[model samples]
Target: MWLDPFLSELQAGDGLPVLDLGCGAGNNALYLTERGVPVVACDLSEEALKLVSERVPEVRTLVLNLLEPLPFGDGTAPAIVADLSLHYFHWADTERIVAELRRVLKPGGLLLCRVNSIRDTEYGAGQGTELEPGLYESGGRIKRFFERDQTEALFANWTIEALEENVLLRYEKPKRAWMVAARRDWA
Candidate 1:
Protein backbone atom coordinates (compact mmCIF):
# COMPACT_ATOMS: atom_id res chain seq x y z
CA MET A 1 0.00 0.00 0.00
CA TRP A 2 1.27 3.48 -0.87
CA LEU A 3 1.32 5.46 2.36
CA ASP A 4 4.30 7.77 2.84
CA PRO A 5 3.87 10.31 0.05
CA PHE A 6 0.16 10.97 0.75
CA LEU A 7 -0.33 10.25 4.45
CA SER A 8 2.84 12.10 5.48
CA GLU A 9 0.81 15.33 5.43
CA LEU A 10 -1.65 14.30 8.15
CA GLN A 11 -1.07 14.73 11.87
CA ALA A 12 -1.80 11.47 13.64
CA GLY A 13 -3.82 11.57 16.84
CA ASP A 14 -5.18 9.20 19.47
CA GLY A 15 -8.79 10.29 18.91
CA LEU A 16 -8.37 9.82 15.18
CA PRO A 17 -7.60 6.17 14.41
CA VAL A 18 -6.63 4.84 11.00
CA LEU A 19 -9.05 2.26 9.61
CA ASP A 20 -7.73 -0.53 7.44
CA LEU A 21 -10.79 -1.57 5.43
CA GLY A 22 -10.72 -5.06 4.01
CA CYS A 23 -7.41 -5.57 5.67
CA GLY A 24 -6.65 -8.84 4.02
CA ALA A 25 -3.32 -10.41 5.05
CA GLY A 26 -2.57 -7.56 7.49
CA ASN A 27 0.31 -6.08 5.52
CA ASN A 28 -1.15 -2.60 5.52
CA ALA A 29 -2.13 -2.90 9.16
CA LEU A 30 1.46 -3.72 9.95
CA TYR A 31 2.55 -0.75 7.88
CA LEU A 32 0.30 1.67 9.78
CA THR A 33 1.19 0.39 13.24
CA GLU A 34 4.90 0.41 12.42
CA ARG A 35 4.52 4.06 11.56
CA GLY A 36 3.07 4.54 15.09
CA VAL A 37 -0.47 5.12 13.86
CA PRO A 38 -3.23 3.36 15.76
CA VAL A 39 -5.21 1.14 13.38
CA VAL A 40 -8.52 -0.69 13.46
CA ALA A 41 -8.21 -3.38 10.85
CA CYS A 42 -11.44 -4.84 9.45
CA ASP A 43 -12.23 -7.64 7.06
CA LEU A 44 -15.07 -10.02 6.11
CA SER A 45 -12.99 -13.17 6.31
CA GLU A 46 -12.52 -14.74 9.70
CA GLU A 47 -9.31 -16.33 8.51
CA ALA A 48 -8.04 -13.01 7.26
CA LEU A 49 -8.87 -11.44 10.61
CA LYS A 50 -7.09 -14.28 12.30
CA LEU A 51 -4.01 -13.67 10.25
CA VAL A 52 -4.07 -10.01 11.13
CA SER A 53 -4.53 -10.76 14.80
CA GLU A 54 -1.69 -13.24 14.81
CA ARG A 55 0.69 -11.00 12.94
CA VAL A 56 -0.10 -7.73 14.67
CA PRO A 57 -1.66 -8.36 18.05
CA GLU A 58 -1.63 -4.64 18.72
CA VAL A 59 -3.98 -3.79 15.86
CA ARG A 60 -7.67 -3.90 16.71
CA THR A 61 -9.33 -6.21 14.19
CA LEU A 62 -12.97 -6.39 13.15
CA VAL A 63 -14.77 -8.70 10.74
CA LEU A 64 -16.55 -6.28 8.46
CA ASN A 65 -18.65 -6.77 5.37
CA LEU A 66 -18.25 -3.49 3.53
CA LEU A 67 -21.57 -3.72 1.65
CA GLU A 68 -23.42 -3.39 4.94
CA PRO A 69 -23.39 -0.25 7.05
CA LEU A 70 -20.07 0.60 8.66
CA PRO A 71 -19.82 0.46 12.46
CA PHE A 72 -17.82 3.59 13.20
CA GLY A 73 -19.30 6.85 14.46
CA ASP A 74 -19.03 9.97 12.35
CA GLY A 75 -15.62 11.61 12.03
CA THR A 76 -13.84 8.75 13.75
CA ALA A 77 -10.79 8.33 11.59
CA PRO A 78 -8.15 10.64 10.18
CA ALA A 79 -6.99 8.13 7.59
CA ILE A 80 -8.55 5.11 5.85
CA VAL A 81 -6.73 2.52 3.79
CA ALA A 82 -8.59 0.32 1.29
CA ASP A 83 -5.79 -1.51 -0.41
CA LEU A 84 -7.15 -3.62 -3.25
CA SER A 85 -10.45 -3.77 -1.42
CA LEU A 86 -12.89 -1.24 -2.96
CA HIS A 87 -13.14 -2.71 -6.44
CA TYR A 88 -15.48 -5.64 -5.85
CA PHE A 89 -18.83 -3.91 -5.63
CA HIS A 90 -21.72 -3.03 -7.88
CA TRP A 91 -22.00 0.61 -8.89
CA ALA A 92 -24.57 1.61 -6.25
CA ASP A 93 -22.86 -0.15 -3.38
CA THR A 94 -19.60 1.42 -4.45
CA GLU A 95 -21.14 4.86 -4.11
CA ARG A 96 -22.55 4.13 -0.64
CA ILE A 97 -19.23 2.77 0.64
CA VAL A 98 -17.42 5.79 -0.74
CA ALA A 99 -19.94 8.10 0.93
CA GLU A 100 -19.64 6.13 4.15
CA LEU A 101 -15.88 6.54 4.05
CA ARG A 102 -16.34 10.26 3.63
CA ARG A 103 -18.96 10.44 6.38
CA VAL A 104 -16.79 8.66 8.91
CA LEU A 105 -13.67 10.66 8.22
CA LYS A 106 -12.93 14.00 9.83
CA PRO A 107 -12.77 16.88 7.45
CA GLY A 108 -9.31 16.88 5.85
CA GLY A 109 -9.00 13.13 6.43
CA LEU A 110 -7.21 11.08 3.81
CA LEU A 111 -8.41 7.95 1.97
CA LEU A 112 -5.92 5.80 0.15
CA CYS A 113 -7.25 3.01 -2.05
CA ARG A 114 -6.34 0.69 -4.93
CA VAL A 115 -8.77 -0.96 -7.35
CA ASN A 116 -8.42 -3.26 -10.31
CA SER A 117 -7.94 -1.39 -13.55
CA ILE A 118 -9.71 -2.03 -16.85
CA ARG A 119 -6.25 -2.74 -18.19
CA ASP A 120 -5.69 -5.60 -15.72
CA THR A 121 -5.50 -8.37 -18.23
CA GLU A 122 -3.34 -10.41 -15.86
CA TYR A 123 -6.21 -10.93 -13.42
CA GLY A 124 -9.00 -11.84 -15.83
CA ALA A 125 -10.23 -8.27 -15.89
CA GLY A 126 -12.24 -8.19 -19.12
CA GLN A 127 -13.76 -11.67 -18.72
CA GLY A 128 -16.66 -10.92 -16.40
CA THR A 129 -20.37 -10.13 -16.76
CA GLU A 130 -21.07 -6.52 -17.52
CA LEU A 131 -23.00 -5.18 -14.56
CA GLU A 132 -22.22 -1.61 -15.61
CA PRO A 133 -19.41 0.34 -17.16
CA GLY A 134 -16.11 -1.20 -16.04
CA LEU A 135 -17.96 -3.50 -13.59
CA TYR A 136 -18.05 -7.23 -14.04
CA GLU A 137 -19.29 -10.42 -12.37
CA SER A 138 -16.46 -12.84 -12.78
CA GLY A 139 -16.37 -16.33 -11.30
CA GLY A 140 -19.53 -15.62 -9.28
CA ARG A 141 -17.93 -12.53 -7.76
CA ILE A 142 -18.67 -8.92 -8.68
CA LYS A 143 -15.51 -7.04 -9.67
CA ARG A 144 -15.34 -3.48 -10.88
CA PHE A 145 -12.45 -2.17 -12.96
CA PHE A 146 -11.94 1.56 -13.09
CA GLU A 147 -11.26 4.00 -15.88
CA ARG A 148 -9.60 7.37 -15.11
CA ASP A 149 -12.71 9.44 -15.81
CA GLN A 150 -14.87 6.99 -13.92
CA THR A 151 -12.58 7.26 -10.90
CA GLU A 152 -12.74 11.05 -11.01
CA ALA A 153 -16.54 10.99 -11.15
CA LEU A 154 -16.73 8.48 -8.32
CA PHE A 155 -14.81 10.73 -5.96
CA ALA A 156 -15.85 14.09 -7.42
CA ASN A 157 -17.07 15.24 -4.03
CA TRP A 158 -13.58 14.98 -2.55
CA THR A 159 -10.29 16.67 -3.22
CA ILE A 160 -8.55 14.06 -5.39
CA GLU A 161 -5.00 14.22 -4.16
CA ALA A 162 -3.51 11.61 -6.47
CA LEU A 163 -5.02 9.29 -9.06
CA GLU A 164 -2.84 7.16 -11.27
CA GLU A 165 -2.57 3.78 -12.98
CA ASN A 166 0.11 1.41 -11.79
CA VAL A 167 0.97 -2.29 -11.93
CA LEU A 168 2.22 -4.46 -9.12
CA LEU A 169 3.21 -8.06 -8.70
CA ARG A 170 0.56 -9.48 -6.43
CA TYR A 171 0.91 -13.20 -5.62
CA GLU A 172 3.57 -13.46 -8.29
CA LYS A 173 1.27 -12.12 -10.99
CA PRO A 174 1.43 -8.66 -12.46
CA LYS A 175 -1.89 -6.95 -11.80
CA ARG A 176 -2.90 -3.62 -13.26
CA ALA A 177 -4.59 -1.31 -10.78
CA TRP A 178 -5.60 2.30 -10.08
CA MET A 179 -4.31 4.05 -7.00
CA VAL A 180 -6.35 6.89 -5.52
CA ALA A 181 -5.37 9.19 -2.71
CA ALA A 182 -8.24 11.55 -1.86
CA ARG A 183 -9.24 13.73 1.06
CA ARG A 184 -12.59 14.84 2.41
CA ASP A 185 -11.90 18.54 2.54
CA TRP A 186 -15.13 19.37 4.35
CA ALA A 187 -17.88 17.69 6.32
Candidate 2:
Protein backbone atom coordinates (compact mmCIF):
# COMPACT_ATOMS: atom_id res chain seq x y z
CA MET A 1 0.00 0.00 0.00
CA TRP A 2 0.79 3.53 0.86
CA LEU A 3 4.12 2.54 2.38
CA ASP A 4 5.38 0.90 -0.78
CA PRO A 5 6.96 4.07 -2.19
CA PHE A 6 8.39 5.07 1.15
CA LEU A 7 10.02 1.64 1.53
CA SER A 8 11.59 1.96 -1.91
CA GLU A 9 14.02 4.49 -0.46
CA LEU A 10 15.57 1.92 1.93
CA GLN A 11 16.36 -0.91 -0.47
CA ALA A 12 20.07 -1.74 -0.72
CA GLY A 13 21.26 -5.00 -2.25
CA ASP A 14 21.74 -7.45 0.62
CA GLY A 15 23.26 -4.72 2.78
CA LEU A 16 20.20 -3.15 4.39
CA PRO A 17 18.17 -4.82 7.12
CA VAL A 18 14.68 -3.63 7.91
CA LEU A 19 12.57 -4.19 10.97
CA ASP A 20 8.91 -4.06 10.08
CA LEU A 21 7.53 -3.19 13.49
CA GLY A 22 3.96 -4.29 14.20
CA CYS A 23 3.90 -5.93 10.82
CA GLY A 24 0.17 -6.72 10.60
CA ALA A 25 -0.41 -9.79 8.45
CA GLY A 26 3.03 -9.12 6.88
CA ASN A 27 1.73 -7.24 3.90
CA ASN A 28 4.36 -4.53 4.15
CA ALA A 29 7.05 -7.05 5.05
CA LEU A 30 6.19 -9.13 2.01
CA TYR A 31 6.23 -6.04 -0.11
CA LEU A 32 9.72 -5.09 1.07
CA THR A 33 10.99 -8.62 0.46
CA GLU A 34 9.71 -8.46 -3.11
CA ARG A 35 11.83 -5.35 -3.46
CA GLY A 36 14.86 -7.36 -2.23
CA VAL A 37 15.18 -5.97 1.27
CA PRO A 38 15.53 -8.46 4.13
CA VAL A 39 12.63 -7.83 6.47
CA VAL A 40 12.07 -8.93 10.02
CA ALA A 41 8.33 -8.89 10.48
CA CYS A 42 7.30 -8.41 14.10
CA ASP A 43 3.94 -8.05 15.81
CA LEU A 44 2.12 -8.85 19.03
CA SER A 45 -0.59 -11.01 17.46
CA GLU A 46 0.24 -14.68 17.10
CA GLU A 47 -2.66 -15.16 14.75
CA ALA A 48 -1.41 -12.34 12.63
CA LEU A 49 2.06 -13.89 12.52
CA LYS A 50 0.55 -17.24 11.57
CA LEU A 51 -1.37 -15.71 8.71
CA VAL A 52 1.73 -13.88 7.56
CA SER A 53 3.77 -17.06 7.60
CA GLU A 54 1.12 -18.84 5.59
CA ARG A 55 0.93 -16.01 3.09
CA VAL A 56 4.61 -15.17 2.74
CA PRO A 57 6.48 -18.34 3.55
CA GLU A 58 9.84 -16.64 3.00
CA VAL A 59 9.37 -13.77 5.44
CA ARG A 60 11.04 -13.82 8.87
CA THR A 61 8.36 -13.27 11.46
CA LEU A 62 8.66 -12.54 15.16
CA VAL A 63 6.14 -12.18 17.96
CA LEU A 64 6.60 -8.83 19.69
CA ASN A 65 4.83 -6.93 22.46
CA LEU A 66 4.94 -3.23 21.71
CA LEU A 67 4.34 -2.33 25.35
CA GLU A 68 7.60 -4.07 26.24
CA PRO A 69 10.97 -2.81 25.08
CA LEU A 70 12.07 -4.14 21.71
CA PRO A 71 14.37 -7.18 21.55
CA PHE A 72 17.23 -5.76 19.53
CA GLY A 73 20.79 -4.67 20.13
CA ASP A 74 22.08 -1.19 19.46
CA GLY A 75 22.66 -0.32 15.79
CA THR A 76 21.45 -3.70 14.63
CA ALA A 77 19.54 -2.48 11.64
CA PRO A 78 19.81 0.24 9.03
CA ALA A 79 16.17 1.08 8.58
CA ILE A 80 13.00 0.56 10.61
CA VAL A 81 9.45 1.04 9.48
CA ALA A 82 6.38 1.09 11.68
CA ASP A 83 3.08 1.62 9.95
CA LEU A 84 -0.09 2.28 11.84
CA SER A 85 1.67 0.80 14.83
CA LEU A 86 2.88 3.59 17.10
CA HIS A 87 -0.63 4.78 17.80
CA TYR A 88 -1.21 1.60 19.79
CA PHE A 89 0.81 3.05 22.63
CA HIS A 90 -0.76 5.54 25.01
CA TRP A 91 0.74 9.01 25.12
CA ALA A 92 2.96 7.99 28.05
CA ASP A 93 4.53 5.04 26.22
CA THR A 94 5.38 6.98 23.10
CA GLU A 95 8.87 7.84 24.32
CA ARG A 96 9.65 4.23 25.16
CA ILE A 97 8.74 3.09 21.69
CA VAL A 98 10.72 5.92 20.12
CA ALA A 99 13.74 5.02 22.19
CA GLU A 100 13.38 1.37 21.30
CA LEU A 101 13.25 2.31 17.65
CA ARG A 102 16.33 4.46 18.01
CA ARG A 103 18.11 1.71 19.91
CA VAL A 104 17.77 -0.84 17.11
CA LEU A 105 18.52 1.61 14.34
CA LYS A 106 22.13 1.96 13.31
CA PRO A 107 23.83 5.33 13.41
CA GLY A 108 22.60 7.42 10.48
CA GLY A 109 19.81 4.90 9.96
CA LEU A 110 16.44 5.93 8.57
CA LEU A 111 13.08 5.50 10.29
CA LEU A 112 9.67 5.78 8.73
CA CYS A 113 6.76 6.04 11.10
CA ARG A 114 3.08 6.21 10.28
CA VAL A 115 0.59 6.97 13.01
CA ASN A 116 -2.92 8.36 13.40
CA SER A 117 -2.88 12.12 13.71
CA ILE A 118 -5.35 14.17 15.70
CA ARG A 119 -6.58 15.73 12.46
CA ASP A 120 -7.81 12.40 11.08
CA THR A 121 -11.28 12.19 9.69
CA GLU A 122 -13.97 10.84 11.98
CA TYR A 123 -14.09 7.69 9.88
CA GLY A 124 -10.56 6.84 10.99
CA ALA A 125 -11.63 6.88 14.63
CA GLY A 126 -11.59 3.55 16.45
CA GLN A 127 -14.44 1.52 17.92
CA GLY A 128 -12.65 -0.50 20.62
CA THR A 129 -12.77 -0.01 24.40
CA GLU A 130 -10.55 2.75 25.69
CA LEU A 131 -7.68 1.65 27.92
CA GLU A 132 -6.01 5.04 28.31
CA PRO A 133 -7.64 8.29 29.26
CA GLY A 134 -7.84 9.80 25.75
CA LEU A 135 -7.08 6.80 23.53
CA TYR A 136 -9.70 4.73 21.75
CA GLU A 137 -10.06 1.01 21.03
CA SER A 138 -10.15 -0.62 17.61
CA GLY A 139 -9.43 -4.07 16.21
CA GLY A 140 -9.15 -5.30 19.80
CA ARG A 141 -6.32 -2.77 20.22
CA ILE A 142 -5.69 0.52 21.96
CA LYS A 143 -4.62 3.65 20.00
CA ARG A 144 -4.30 7.39 20.28
CA PHE A 145 -4.31 10.16 17.70
CA PHE A 146 -1.52 12.76 17.58
CA GLU A 147 -1.30 16.27 16.31
CA ARG A 148 1.61 17.09 13.98
CA ASP A 149 3.73 18.91 16.55
CA GLN A 150 2.93 16.31 19.21
CA THR A 151 4.33 13.57 17.00
CA GLU A 152 7.38 15.63 16.05
CA ALA A 153 8.22 16.24 19.69
CA LEU A 154 8.30 12.48 20.36
CA PHE A 155 11.34 12.04 18.09
CA ALA A 156 12.94 15.36 18.77
CA ASN A 157 16.54 14.25 18.37
CA TRP A 158 16.24 13.11 14.80
CA THR A 159 16.40 15.42 11.82
CA ILE A 160 13.16 15.17 9.89
CA GLU A 161 13.81 14.54 6.20
CA ALA A 162 10.26 14.32 4.97
CA LEU A 163 6.78 14.81 6.31
CA GLU A 164 3.49 14.39 4.48
CA GLU A 165 -0.13 14.23 5.57
CA ASN A 166 -2.56 12.48 3.31
CA VAL A 167 -6.32 12.20 3.56
CA LEU A 168 -7.32 9.00 1.80
CA LEU A 169 -10.68 9.09 0.11
CA ARG A 170 -11.82 5.52 0.47
CA TYR A 171 -15.35 4.52 -0.45
CA GLU A 172 -16.49 8.08 0.00
CA LYS A 173 -14.88 8.26 3.44
CA PRO A 174 -11.64 9.90 4.48
CA LYS A 175 -8.70 8.10 6.11
CA ARG A 176 -5.99 9.98 7.94
CA ALA A 177 -2.38 9.58 6.92
CA TRP A 178 0.66 10.81 8.81
CA MET A 179 3.94 9.76 7.20
CA VAL A 180 7.39 10.91 8.29
CA ALA A 181 11.02 9.90 7.78
CA ALA A 182 13.89 10.90 10.05
CA ARG A 183 17.54 10.01 10.38
CA ARG A 184 19.52 9.22 13.52
CA ASP A 185 22.66 11.28 13.96
CA TRP A 186 25.75 9.36 12.88
CA ALA A 187 27.66 10.39 15.98
Top of the candidates by lDDT: 1
Off by over 4 Å in 2: 4-8, 13-16, 123-134, 137-141, 169-172
Instruction: Give one digit per residue, the lDDT tens place, for model 2 in 63-98.
Output: 999778788899888899898888867777888888
TM-score of 2: 0.85
What are the lDDT figures for the candidates, one per model?
0.86, 0.79
Candidate 2 — worst ten consecutive residues by lDDT sum?
Answer: 121-130
**Per-residue C-alpha lDDT of model 1 across residues 84-150, encoded as one tens digit per residue:** 9999888899999999999988888889999889998778678867888888787788888899998
- The segments of candidate 1 whose C-alpha lies over 4 angstroms from its true place after superposition are none
List RMSD in Å for every model shown. Answer: 1.4, 2.9
TM-score of 1: 0.94
